[model samples]
Target: MSDTLLKPHPLDEATYLRSLGPGRLAGRTSAAYWNMAGPFGGTTAAILLRAVMEHPDRRGRPVAQTVNFCAAVAEGEFEVLVRLVRDGRSTQHWLVELVQGDVVAATASTVTGPSRETWSHRPGAPPPMPPSQALAPLPTEGRNAWLGRYEFRFERGEPIPGRASAEAPAPALSRAWVRDAPPRPLDYVALAALADTFVVKILQVRGDIPPVATVSMTTYFLADEAEMARQGEDYLLCTADARAFKHGFNDQTAELWSAGGELLAVSNQVVWFKG
Candidate 1:
């Protein structure tokens, strides 16, 4: 990715109509851009949110998003269309569709809102780990890669370097700091996308082969800019847990924190893997 900062504009009817042309996926094929698993649900959400955030009208704000994967997107040209469902003073709703040759590969709905006081709560923050402890760098080389578009530093158990790992006991807990390319300040939407990074740590803990892939993820924002910015760096401490299991599925929960141990967001993702 380029070091240039990206400022997105709102998706008006005119821009949406013109965006029907070929879309770029980090300079790669849109389909293969984020095929972490066979399904690109989380990737779809990331792309859609990035596009929506670029919109001139709703560039900086908290947004709630839900996406449904309809079909697999293969490598090639594609387009995204955004529709304004409702635009209110405090909140706005948008619908986005990913299309390839007239095929609807994926779709998403997002809601953006300003901070308002309805209720509040303070929960105990996750235990801290010294940043000076043995930390593993993210694997960025070879095929079947792990961390691609993000930079990370493990604060706990050693992450199996490269794409392959010798089967061993999975750790009960792990912590890591995550950030995107160029390490600029990211908004809530981008933070939500980064929250999914813990899925790798969770699967590693479970000793699951082929690494489990996320089916769905939901994140709740818990802090304001002043709180987030106070962390010093755009980095966030992510801690994950694989608490329960059933017929071929597992539940994982992760919390995002600032370097000062301030909780910024919490996330839960349903993951499944093939034997």
Candidate 2:
């Protein structure tokens, strides 16, 4: 128990938050958090969303966003360039790119739309799972540092080390309750990051934690500010499943739900994995 271990995570404060710059926004990298490769994809996504949210010309709220990982990000200062694609009466679109030392690490497209009321019907079924309090907390000992920032109460698919042996292979699905540890407010930026929080789908299905990286990720936001606030810091029900795995690549889909049975966001990604 030392003061060094008790300090807030670099990302917990202003790490991903960017400052306005000449032609592009500028931001610093987090020194305390890193995955097997580079900075966590969740923080990367949050920064991309922050670029759009802070843009002077940005209109409406976030509806959908897609981030493509082009290369590994360097651990230092980076620049984010955003361009307004289309500005409609009710909706707006944007394109963003994050660059570090002339290398484009990530690119994204975001769509925002004003809120309106109309007749609507949801055909989706409610989330079928036990309460968050009923689930057991997953152990995190030797995993990436970023995984330790969030609390996961897993209903299934814990990715225990020995469970992935050749004799007993876990299913390719994960159902869990997830949320930030210190209870941050729910917003598009936070939710966008959370959408990518699930463990890579390939590991759960293939029963081995191999090298994994998300090549591309697309997310659709379903809830508004009210619904997001209603959920608060309560654990969100989340599930991720691999749809296909072939040729060193896999496609996965994920969904996040509110405690009161509301769909918060849905995400799909194509990931590169090693056997």
Candidate 3:
């Protein structure tokens, strides 16, 4: 891992939240900036969730979040405003806005829970690959920022040729092994930040032109950090659909797994392609 990746101190929920007070409205950028691709939708969402989890009322439960990217935000100082949409004994809903100047760059809705049904099911797992054989070495330098903090090995497919070529067809699917560099166990917030890593691969396989920038991502945390770390490995399987459409938008679904093959979370996003 590079020294820059190791620079930011790991923060628990409380400390991270406290850092965002009045004087600290502008947020910290992640090491994965280059891999962020389009507008920082995932970063905006992650920051908002960090704020929500930092609130006094949060009880360290699973949170289901839906975020919409309304506009692009340049990397730098920004503000997040969180509102309590509803609070109940078992669940809470919050609305968050990511702001830069007068613009609402992104908006999100979050639902935190204390109770939910036990029954669970997920789509079929991706084909298995051994951790020892599959782990890709981390790149010494990255085209985008986030690549520095992670060691990523693509298990399937390749990056589309050229940066702006929309003429190429999207691949059907892609898989990758991802681990944090200098390997520290990450809490839900940190893991959520990593989950945004899925977008680049999804777009790589989704269309010939690869305009699949993330519009929003919704994640549900299913287990604790210790459990996630215990699993030994993390794999991301991204599949996209070109069919579902609304208001000129399309949706793609992604599933994440621990090394033990347990389902970690599911993400769905709306993407708009540039013509």
**lDDT per model vs. reference:** 0.60, 0.81, 0.60
Model 3 ranges with Cα > 4 A deviation:
1-26, 30-40, 115-126, 138-142, 162-170, 199-203, 206-212, 232-248
Kindly list the per-residue Cα lDDT of model 1 for residues 96-185, writing each as its tens digit: 777777688767677777766678776686676656335666776652332455667877644554432335546646677777644546
Candidate 1 positional error at 64, Å? 2.3
Error of 3 at 275 (Å): 1.8
* Model 1 clash tally, residue pairs: 6
1-275: candidate 2 lDDT, tens digit per residue: 99967876445553455567633888877754577878889888888888888888887789999999999988788889888889999889999999988799999999998767888788876568888788877766677877876789988877665566545556778889998765666778878888988887656665676887999999999998889989987888888887677898988889998878899899999999887
RMSD of each predicted structure: 5.8, 3.1, 4.6
Single out the weakest 10-residue window by summed lDDT for candidate 1. Answer: 8-17
Query: Candidate 2 — what's its lDDT?
Result: 0.81
> Model 1 — TM-score against the truth?
0.72
C-alpha TM-scores of all predictions: 0.72, 0.91, 0.76
- Using lDDT as the measure, the top candidate is 2
Model 2 poorest ten-residue lDDT run: 9-18
